[model samples]
Target chain A: MNNWYMLTLVGNDRTGIVAKVTRILQQNNCQLGEASMLRLGGNFTIMMMVNSELSSDDIITALQAISAELNLQVHLDEIEGRLHEHHIPNVLVTVIGADRGGIIAQVTEKLFNVGFDILNLDSDVAGTDERAIYIMRIEGQALDGIESIEAALQPLKADGIDISVQAIETLIA
Target chain B: MAIHPILTYPNQQLKQVSQPVDNFDHNLRAFIDELQETMHDGPGAVGIAAPQIGHAIRLVIVDVSNKKKIKHHGHLVLVNPEIVEWQGLAVGREGCLSVPDFTGNVVRAERIKLNAFDAYGEPLSFEMEGYEARALQHEIDHLDGLLFLDRLVSRRNDLFERKKR
Candidate 1:
């Protein structure tokens, strides 16, 4: 395979969000390798794996244009060499407790600052009125493994959030 | 005498709780051998339980050397195992051979003090930590007819159909 790319899009839920994003990638000759799409609350989430012989610059420019037009947040990163041979180090992060507005942004921002690439994430508001519970399993990849992550997430302790991390092996790019 | 085919989900056989080894007969030797063989045969496979091979016996063979993370932890073969005590809770993503095509977050005990009969029928007690504990617990759960799917603490948005390579 040629170079591999991971691109993600998240924004206000709208019709044709996927088609518009994919259409741009297809124009840039990016091969869709993997994809996951979901609508949570009022937002649409799209994560895709793409392959192209072109430089990261070419793909990023195309994605940036679409993000501007659609008002979506986007991220793109390239995988290379020996690191490409190893399976993406997917980590499962589970957070269970009461629901709140800034959970995704807060958790994901932590992951992003430390170079974690989210693969699949799904959350639901569970339980009844007196005791409400929110359970979410976010699948992500961090090639550096648990040591780096453990240090990066020390602040989460203040929030009384339970954290568990497991390194996963899934597909060589 | 050889690696046995893993009885995947919907096979019905994988869901049945295994019978306890009453006498440690010749058949028990063969069952343990096959479980060890099968674990070595798969690419990243570490352990195999009796139910996973269509046998309903309280036995599981684990060798974590093949897994990079727990390679230094060495091999563990547990027969009629019991976790005497455990401390603290840790969540990990666990997958089983019987439950092919998916993995999920499972909260399991982080450290375990347990006892089991070894290959020579001698009682042995040990304390295991980290990923090793998770792997051992996962295999033992199979002996009780519980697949990793049963331990899925959360659900993904989609069914996540696996396409064989």
Candidate 2:
């Protein structure tokens, strides 16, 4: 059986974390697969699935040594395998205009209830702090059509708040 | 001859920067005709680029005049087109025939002053606003090896997987 593992590393936000972690993994003859590194709030985090020749126990000991040295929280565990992109119809939902509370909640709730799969979402509070503007882009699968999704988002629109849902073929590009 | 096959991504040719259309000959006119035919054959297509038809030349056609209510320059064959000045911003949902199956919300110049040579090799310059301006910008990007994806507001969330048309 192939040895596939999920590895997560979180520590203070600093450079060289990736270099160090990957170097260790590289020394162990581990091939990095889908990996993501994110800086959240104040700390940084790294998550990846890797295929390796080393066993789980061997990887755990190697990672623990680095964890103690770098003041990081490291977790390594065996996993089944990987997930590939599915051939599903996806939609792009963009919401802009005035910033207000409960906007994300309201929008997400409606989309979720209607079978829209939230693949990716990014939002920002721009304009000015006094006249705070909220802009968001959501990529997901809308099982229904764009018209129905638009209708679902209709109530969210006000004088300045604009919400639009349209079919997007994102994977193509 | 007739409608040519639209090249999709990874075709290498789509990314190659197009050379300027230096000559306005019979072949150029026929190529423009083929592009018009291809655009009409596409699903709600508004414009097409020469690179999309395997010709790396600065030439594109746009005809949004027939679709809905919008002031337009009618069917235009802009050769070596350039946007001299731009103003304001408009966000519109756009799809490309070459990049089929996907559409994106792109922010474009709400108004523009464009300068270009017509299909007959005559110099033409004019101002375009609203939908017409947006369409011209989208088609022009293709000549410069740019796709709507490159202009997406946010790649992570702005990109959507479209259902097959």
State each model's C-alpha RMSD to the native.
Answer: 10.3, 6.5
Indicate the DockQ of the complex predicted as candidate 1: 0.07
Poorest lDDT segment (10 consecutive residues) of candidate 1 chain B:
B156-165
Candidate 1's displacement at residue A138, Å, is 5.1
Give per-residue CA lDDT, model 1, range A14-108, as digits (tens).
Answer: 89889988888889888887567888767998777788877887887877877888789887778632322323336766666676677778777
Q: After superposition, how far is residue B105 of candidate 1 from its true place, in Å?
A: 0.7
Writing each residue's lDDT as its tens digit, candidate 2 over A1-173 gives 36789998899988778888889989988888777777764678888987887888888787777778788898888897755543343577888878888889999998987888887677777787689888888878888867768778888775457877766532121
Which prediction has the highest DockQ against the true structure? 2
i-RMSD values for every candidate model? 10.8, 8.3
Among these predictions, the greatest TM-score belongs to 2
Off by over 4 Å in 1: A1-89, A92-117, A121-138, A143-173, B66-73, B155-165
B69, model 2: CA deviation in Å? 7.3
Show model 2 residue runs off by greater than 4 Å. Answer: A1-8, A22-36, A47-68, A74-106, A123-137, A141-173, B2-17, B33-46, B63-76, B90-107, B122-132, B145-165
Model 1 TM-score relative to the real fold: 0.56
